[model samples]
Target: MDLDNLIVMANRIGLFFAAQPDRDEAMAGIAEHVKKFWEPRMRSQILAAIGTEAGAGLSEIVAAALTTHRAMLQPA
Candidate 1:
């Protein structure tokens, strides 16, 4: 899948979870959703986006979630 498309999808997931009242809970929801639903390759690509210029398009919430929960999101 395209990186741009993955970024858009991840951001959309973040948007959905952003409605949650608790910030931690929303970030967790975003992480869990991707961990459970996204394939390892997809997960790897998204994780690679963090702190990189290609990921500049990522929404703030999505970028934070990726940065905050990187340990678990990493693909073995």
Candidate 2:
């Protein structure tokens, strides 16, 4: 998938989890959703984008979730 599309999807997930009362849980929820539903290649591409200018488009919560749960999102 394209990086922009990935960002949109991740941000959408973040939007859903943002309603959670606990910030940590929200981030974790975002990470878990990505980890569970996205394929390894898609996850890898998103991870790479997270370090680049394209990543700036990501929502604050999505960026935080990507940063905080990076290890878990990495492909084996």
What TM value does model 1 have?
A: 0.96
What's the count of clashing pairs in each model shown?
0, 0
User: What lDDT does the true structure give each of the candidates?
Assistant: 0.93, 0.92
Please write out the lDDT profile of model 2 over residues 1-76, one tens digit for every residue: 8898999898889989999999999999999999999999999998888868978899988888989999999999
Off by over 4 Å in 2: none
Model 2 global lDDT (CA atoms, 0 to 1): 0.92
The candidate that achieves the highest lDDT relative to the unseen native structure:
1
Model 1 Cα lDDT, one tens digit per residue, 1-76: 8999999999999999999999999999999999999999999998987889998999898899988999999998
RMSD of each: 0.7, 0.7
